[model samples]
Target: MMVNCCGLLTSQKEPVPLKSVEVELEVRDHVATVVSTLSYENKEDKPLEAVFVFPLPGDAAVCHFSAQIGQMQIVAEVKEKQEAREEYDDALSSGQQAFLLEESEQSPDIFSLSVGSLPPGESASIRLEYVTELAVQADDGLRFCLPAVLNPRYQPQGSGGGEGGNVQVTSVQVTSVPASLVPYSLSFSARVSSPRPVSKVESNCPLDPLQYLNTEQTQTTVKLAAGHKFDRDVELLIYYKDAHQPTAVVEAGRASSEPGTLMGDPVMMLSLYPEFPQAVMSSVASCGEFVFLLDRSGSMQGARMKSAMDTLLLLLKSLPMGCYFNIHSFGSSYEHIFPESVEYNQKTMEEALKNVAEMKANLGGTEILKPLKHIYSQPCIPSQPRQLFVFTDGEVGNTKDVINLVKQNSGSHRCFSFGIGEGASSALINGLAKEGGGHAQFITGTDRMQPKVMQSLRFALQPAVQDISVKWDLPKGVSVIDLSPPITALFQGQRSLVYAQLTGQGSEASEGCVTVRYSLAGHPSQNQLHFSLKPAEDTGLTVHRLAARTLIRSLEMEKREWRGQEDGGDKKKKVVELSVQSGVSSAFTAFIAVNKGNSEVIQGPLVRRNVPTPMVMACGMRRQCVPMSYDASPVMNMMALRQAEPCSLKKRSLPKQPPRDPLLQLVSLQKASGCWVLDPDLAAALGKTSEEVEKPKPASVNQEVWATILALIWLHGFKMDAQEEWELLAMKAVSWLQAQKASCVTECVDAGNALLGCTVQKDVLGL
Candidate 1:
């Protein structure tokens, strides 16, 4: 979640310093370089100071920060956090123009910026640049998000608060305000180039038609519509002809920097897409211990609660019969469906489904750590690997603590996490998956959770990739120093990135090969890529900055693990040194810029102003925005952001009927064994009467077998596009039909396909 907003301004009519923002996005392959420029004007009588806080992607490496006042410009320098703060204070006291930016001590995703000693009637421009890799969506699209999380985090007492106990988050009360009401102007543009052909681009926000630069369709440009306001999150999903191709980019280092340093040498980024054998992929595992953790916090009141329940129903119905499973929900406290995980059977599944239906968002606040700790404490079932599925809106205050706990127990279990709703913490969601040897997915803005959830479940069922190692083979006199941590998990078609330093000297025409070796389900295999060592032309220091950020994060995690030990200090020093050398902002570093051009020191008492930002949102296009009103100011102090409690009368619980969804209706009729019996509900789901479906059944086929085949055929015919959501359950049904060993299986399939008006073949339905 990354949002830029001011706190508040005195006299709403008074002009504020911050006026407008313009952003440029340059995407080269999977990496993105973003540049944002903000224009501010001080219209007050005396010299004043302004402070603003905002959110950023947790993994982004902020590489540049600068400010321009009139004709003079100052480029900020990255320095130790304490030293930068002291310099900022000294410059402010001396009445010199200064700017300071630093990450929160507790939350990496939040930062504060202060502008000091700005003279009256002066205009200034601030520029910030960063680089980050895009996340790969389940459908193979590359996802880039300009995230806007207006909702303040929800936290309870002692729910993962950090050592820096003073946490403050500003919230403004309003519904969906119109974009025109916002004071600031915004413009966004993007240029995308890829090795593969650019198929298309889609976004949650409206964009001008994509313009291709060449006939090959490898390069293109797109921009936001003229009427777009910087209110809601802006997301872009880019697709390519072959998205799974592996790539390697080698970038040259800065000339002025000394050799043998992170900045002065060549850096290589390897993008590896693992390939799994089809024999293993075709079979879904039926044995595992599946545990689900859900967030029942008060913030998850309406739509979120409904989606969460719908996803749980799909999960419960799709589980393999021999597996063990349990359901856990948490708020300020936690509760479980059973004392421990119970075997997955008809009775247990029914009981779990019934309890799931009754669950609500009435649980007080977000406290996920307790439930996670409890789950990890439970004994792992022998021969049944533990797969933990965690779902939340990601509002916890102790994100680092929770992530560390996941890493500690990562050896025994795999964690699949889902960040539900807008404003979910990317840090918490990505951190849990990265540490627990599983995958993470974010569901937001009309995105269906069931598909993404089922995809992750498939990853969980895939045989684990173990004993992974990366080996680099370069020319003589060239050695490599790996920057990324060791690979712990891999899923078929998922991209894994590796960064390394190219040390020593090599000919410009030298070619190098890198091999990735891993064992999947006891079969040892390897993937190799050979590429030229020549430094890429016109490729800036984006790769180096990202590499530095990765190393810094790995070291920070190590520092946390080595806390109170002598090695921790060394790791901290290394992080600060590398951060300064690479000109990137880290938790231990801050960016500071100062101006001493004004020789006169005739400043009086300086007034401080906090600008207020109203959050006006528009969904898909420029012509439409949510009609409600909202005031979302994003100046944060790494504390829990709870919606200010509204005193209301306690409401009585009502037994409401579940809505009749065609998909869920069909899904619910499938038994635990994955066979559908002939019933009126099943017929209704398939849009036919029970007698009509029963009359055409083959003489050799029983009612159960015919109904099961009909369900499979209907899913293939009507819901083919949503295969990701129902693929697992459909596979189970196919397995059950095979187990029956009916002689007329093909006859039943052909008849069912004709009845459903589907041309699907027996093989396609897995009959």
Candidate 2:
């Protein structure tokens, strides 16, 4: 998780720069040219000083452009325009162009400047105009940054005119560029510099993969013979030392063909791992008090909203018997569905879920931090495990303020945050969680939220091991260290994970026991658990921060590479440390490297299992994401496919590329037909029937026609009765097609017509 370590500042104040990135690229006649434009909008309550900096490529053969900022006089730069050799179309029109002005059929370039930084409620627009020669190529070669500065600040513009100083820009846009010239990289960052520093800063961690694994049922294993691939799920044990109880994590699973044997189709597979110490289950417990902050924002209108609701329903249904909970939802406005924290009675819970279902999302502004402050100020119910769970897609009105608020209010209450979807603010969620002494979790897509919600709810209900804290035992010369927050509240017997970083040249590893102090609900004194960290042979400062730093740097560099090609060369840049960092850690770093490209194509054990298949296609939009098992469960496969490609069903067949597996289709059809059933006629035709010579029955009327051709061939023994067979096949085919509403889906009608036309017209009608 990337974080701006500074304390929260008021939105009314100016923002200071915390970091700067610049990108450089070679320019040539053959290289992609920079086609740029700028548009400005003032939507805020202040006049924002906008400065757009588009740096030139290092090896530019030529560069030319006209620039302007509204009606104000501004300095503009002009470079030599590259020579063009294409035949000029003088007769096309008076505006006959020399360069090829090919327009893309889709995804044309556009620059929009909406009103921004108007007085409290007003709005205004800033104009922009620019043009450059077309350097046709597959790749882009220019760079730019929105607010290109190191220490940026802004002030609210009053009715009086103020001194017009150097304007600093924070964002950029492209114009007159081909769709194919789109770059494959992009980076985004916002930092708070020179701010009021109250306390802590945080780093956001990627969501735990185990949270996506479905675990509602007992672990089931299926054995596969050689040459078989089976999709499935398995339970993983989440254990920590000195915790009350161990937690179980489920994983969606799959096993491909193992080594030898004739590979016809994938069948089944399973595994048995070495078991750890026997886990002791703890008594059922419930939190003292809880608040569920849900987002009912506009962007979460369809599938995402459905998934969120469904997951909420599941949690409501499974809440502990005596737990107390509150329901809070926000979008343009905030609503406490339950006026106050209420007991977990069946009626109240049902009413809450119903309210969520009936909710009409009033999508507009996102006022995140304000509502939390209100909730925090309310009097708490004493003696209960007091906590708040902020559930959102992580968009915020002001991130820094929200983080600071959570941190300040977290002394007596724990705040756990769950990011619902891709647009969620990682930094905000992480900060809220860290400040509230809770773990922050991110759900990438709607379908992934259910399992995570279930696991989190279960954990929240478990007895806490007590408040956990961490302090660095700094070695000599180690200064200016940056440390991640301490993870608190382990299960009664579980261990906590706490890490810290120290800056400096030299520091020897020291032997010391890190003490974890916590207390059970109703317990007397705090219990102190100690874990010894004997400086392993590997105690290098760089070694410890390798994983964390690499992930950050790789993402940073990727953004620069992206800007180089997108906004037309050298407008933005980053150091190569990013790529090096991506090569380090085995886990987190791997995510950074792969996240830069298409996730599906960069396959891995986890990636393969998560890739959308036919199963996902059939699930439709989830009301709430539920933990999913990828095993050979026909229902699950259908559900996966439904959610992933709801529209893919319109297509008759899956992609024909042989490299693309046909198994997904087969599995889809199998599930659609209600699982495997004996094909009696095929068995009879093979003379391998087991006293059951059943006639061919189509899975549906559509498939029944497909069976008719085979039945006719069998009846006439493939000879003299060919015409009769043709007539029968045609009759059945047309009838089945009609019943199946063939015309509704073109594929069914087309297939039916082709088959009947082939047999009836050629043999029976002789036309």
Maximum-lDDT candidate: 1
Candidate 1 residue-pair clash tally: 13
Q: Candidate 2 at 473: error in angstroms?
A: 9.7
lDDT of 2 by residue, 1-767 (tens): 75443421112122211111211211111112223333223333433322222222111112122223234322212111111111212211222211111111010111112211112222222212221111110011111112111100111122121101111111221111111221111122212111122121111221122221124311111111222111111111121122122111111111242222111111111111111122322344544687888776544555566667756665554455466888888755688877789887657776787687787444333456557877887788876677788777554424445666776676677777786643344445655765576666655522356555655555566555455443334335533222234355453322233223323333333222233344445342333322222232321222223223323322332332453366423322222222122222110111010011112221111100011111111123332332122223323432332233232245577545343112111111111111122355344442335233233233343444343333332223323322321232223333443454432233323332343232322133111
Positional deviation of residue 458's Cα in model 2 after best superposition, in angstroms:
1.4
Model 1 per-residue lDDT tens digits across residues 221-304: 999989886666678999999899988889999999888898999999999998888998887888999999999876676668
C-alpha TM-score for every candidate? 0.90, 0.38
Most accurate candidate by TM-score? 1
The list of candidate 2 runs beyond 4 A from truth reads 1-182, 185-281, 467-488, 491-510, 522-767
Give candidate 1 regions above 4 Å deviation: 1-15, 155-182, 613-659, 750-759
TM-score of 1: 0.90
Error of 1 at 196 (Å): 1.9
